[model samples]
Target: MQVLRWDGGGPMLATRDSSTLTVLIGTFAVLWLLWAIKKQRKAAVHPLPPGPRGLPIVGYLPFVGTELHTKFHQLCGIYGPIYKVWLGNKLSIVISSPSLVKEVVRDQDAIFSNRDTNIVGRTITYGGADIALSLNCPNWKMLRKIFVREMLSPTNLDITLALRREEVRKTIRNVYDKKGTHIDLGDLAFITVMNAIMNMLWGGTLRGEEGAKFGAEFKHIFAELVMILGKPNVSDLFPALARFDLQGIRRKAKRISETIDRVLDYAIDKQIKSLAKAKEEGTTKTEQKDFLQVLLELSEQDDGAPSMIMTQIKALVFLS
Candidate 1:
């Protein structure tokens, strides 16, 4: 623990030990006085929510446990729906009641629209430009519009309907052909779902044994990636030590990101070549192009706002 000293503006004591004790005592009293006055003034301005008292520096973390869900209910019963809890340097407010939740989410969405982005999230999202992690702004709105209006519009869905139908049909046929063979329904469903998302993201589809093999690889790799993302890293908690990457979380993240980039590069190259051929032939060859193509096209346009970059494109692709 780092010990911070304050030069208390109070009467000095005789001995060194006595002076130190006096300074500490004076500092605590002054801080407590200021906090009390501020809280009183704030209460006068607007009624504050109730919560348990916390110790200095550590906040409520030392008392929390793995069973946070249960603890949340107990705390709610005591402090009501809207209460605050400090986790390290962060202050978290929980809202359990539907009415208050609505006030925050629906009534005043703009005030609380953006979710907090952490250090690990920034690394995973390539500086946090991804649609999911980005702050609420025109850039985020643009990405959402491209995703919803361009990629998921009625025209685009109609074009890709056949591809989705094809994958589902294949899955059904495989199930029928296998009959009584021992199978993992969860994995089968996972692969089918992954294939559908992959198709939508990059206009690629893995099928039969190939689909199963790719899906298995992805399941293991992505599970590990997710675990690393969720793992507590000392580096993230202490930004001063962030460069060390002490837990190797950032290192693993870089490796995973490289793999994803390589895959996206290959897919992007194939799409470009196909698009070029179609342009030359003066015809359309396949269904609506994937989100990558849409993004690439948008990036080519030099608008007032900053053009989308490859990192952001990869972030979106990784999410899909």
Candidate 2:
């Protein structure tokens, strides 16, 4: 018993161990306080939707299946027609049942008619100047009226139908010529539809290298836009994180916008020049009526003034 002497190193080692423990404890306390503060702030701003709790920061993003529509419908079955899910920090209200959809889309149309601004629509529609994607304000209403009255009216339907018939006939003729040869029906259909739309809008068909370039560009851009729109974005959920734009959505939108602007600018310039030439020669005729002529005439009138901007004209022309 007397041989059990005091070890001098014991106290020094104990002191070091205690110091490390203190540091770790302090760090943990600080982290916990910060987390509490964040939770308090979130709770103060917007009430969390009634739903299952999700993991920290990530929310229910990982639990969502590959097919969003299917997952949404499934969730609706469990949570009812109107259920909320978090992509990250943002909350998305899913409307699945037909009755709920009708109530929201039809009955409360005015309240819910505003367009959802996202990366893709902003890019593809020139910051949403196009009638289809633009905000549901007076400007949008004006454009919509113009589109309905001038471009897609019952009278104009005949123009579109005639062009469609001619295009289809030409496509059939081409297929007949290529009989027994391997051909893509989808591609032929796309070409026919695009040519018909273009002819109706501009009174001419896209052809040669320019046509090929425009077709490829439009298809590529449209595909990109569709893909983006079809997918729900994580950025939309977290407004604070939107500044980061983690998926490069904004960048892609800018690139698409620039490409579209270039093509549209050329088309507008050509149309303006044509209008000027026709005016100079007194050959501006309405017998060969088209969407452009109608829009120009409406632009000059103030009977139902809508403050139509040049950008609106460009957007309408591109869409037509």
Candidate 3:
């Protein structure tokens, strides 16, 4: 049997096949032209921050690697104090030197106050529910004010100082007990600070294995979120490629978010149930007049009136 070939051999290939090939080429050409036009339009609208040139699609993602701070610092040394870096479709301005940081953060705070909404931040902070991660808006402003007034105010601190003192004394006692043993000072200091913060936020101590587990999980989730946001994200650099979500960043963010939500929900539900019982019994006495109690009281007021809720309280707790 003779083998057929593209070359002029046997019967010539059909004219229809050549026409189909022509149509395919034309289609690809038109699509590419349209894409170029769209890209040009976007470029005209939002001029990208000035930075070192990068590869197409991936941008400077490969160059960033994992150590974001180190990579940014290195780039800053070469490109001066302020420079831009791309991760996939996203662009970020890196402020390295203290002078530049002061200029942007202190002087131009109004311009930079509104945070850039990133996929990672949105997921980890419960769709921007947390004050630290939320965008600058009316809700954020109100929450921030409440946080300052209710949690971090000078009067609140005065009330909480006794608790802080007790926690610190316990920490010192524990350190003294471990004097004979090989104690990790770093671990001890971390636990001390964490316990102080937790006690202030929850009006309780983080003791025993169960509390340890919660602390470990919370720390891991928080650290992961900070790491993800701090690093160069490809999705932010290239918005077009954001849908692809390479590196599974969005999935990881969602998983971390769910874990945080579970913890916060458990705490809030307990507080709400206790508050409901107290109201039903008509008891003016409270076992503990904690931040949660104050928030519940505020939430009971008219919706039109200024109020606070579990979400805002939880955000304040985290911020504290």
Candidate 4:
């Protein structure tokens, strides 16, 4: 600078900085415009209640903190019964008052029937075929009807009571066997619950070591899946960038999902083969039907379009 030498670096550095500043300014302007448009559209439909505003990219999600209930309590004090919080790109409306909840659930049930699901939710639910994530459509209606009217009806519950009793007795026996020694209460309880649930799902389709291994695998995978789903993924925020999977969330989800799918395949195939053998031998089928048997029967029904399919069956098993 003292000599004002004609070294090429100074002017080029200034030019690069100028270009970077322009790009950042342009990006901010575009973001603001899009946000403004979205606000306008939401206002046009119905003006949302007020809440704390957040940063540019991430919203209130970062500040939600570990004590979510406490944060919610604070927000309720400030924003009253109803308020909206932006979770990254997702807009979540929180209703604190019971009356407002009733108004939304009972009065406007149809409008609120379908809920938004993220990429991991869709991937794990097999594109929303399962009851947990399926859209409110004819298929969903059918699935719900079958689930409630057949699998969870009072009659089915009574029929499956024995299975529950058996699992409880198994736990009791194990505890009795380990009475003199130190026993892991948590492991004991978990295995008992898993056994009971599997019995209700498909009777003995998974039992002993198979049930234990499958439950362990499923539990670990599902925990990871939930974490990935809850974490902020660039792909989820910007749908266009999903194909790139820059964060690799999708790849991890797919790998775990395939492992689950394989387990489901084995269970379904084993059950089908068992049913076929029972039919071939002309043995009287068990009067108490597990959820899987009901699903298989529904899948086989030829009247009025197939109500369920193998994919749907797999999803139901996974959900169970």
C-alpha root-mean-square deviation, each candidate: 9.0, 9.3, 8.7, 10.2
What TM-score fits each model?
A: 0.76, 0.75, 0.70, 0.78
- Clash totals for all models, in order? 0, 1, 10, 0
Output the worst ten-in-a-row residue range by lDDT, candidate 3: 284-293
Tens digits of per-residue lDDT, candidate 3, 95-182, equal 7788888988899876788877888867665566777776778787877776788667786676667657767998889988888888
Q: Which tens-of-lDDT digit does each residue in 58-103 have in candidate 4?
A: 7887898888779988999999999999877777888889999998
- Poorest 10 consecutive residues by lDDT, candidate 1: 203-212
lDDT of 2 by residue, 1-320 (tens): 12233588552224556668999999999999999999999888976445656788888888987887788777777878777786787667777779989998999988888856776666666688889888778888889898988778987666556556766787889999999999998889887777666656644333446655665677677677667677666567676777788888777777877887887676556666777787899886454345665566667678857667778877887776
TM-score order of candidates, top first: 4, 1, 2, 3
Judging by TM-score against the true structure, name the best candidate: 4
lDDT by residue for model 1 (183-230), tens: 899989987887776666654433356545644555566777889887
Clashes of 2: 1
State the C-alpha lDDT per candidate. 0.75, 0.72, 0.71, 0.80
Q: How accurate is candidate 1 locally (lDDT)?
A: 0.75
Better of 1 and 3 by lDDT: 1
Clashing pairs in 1: none
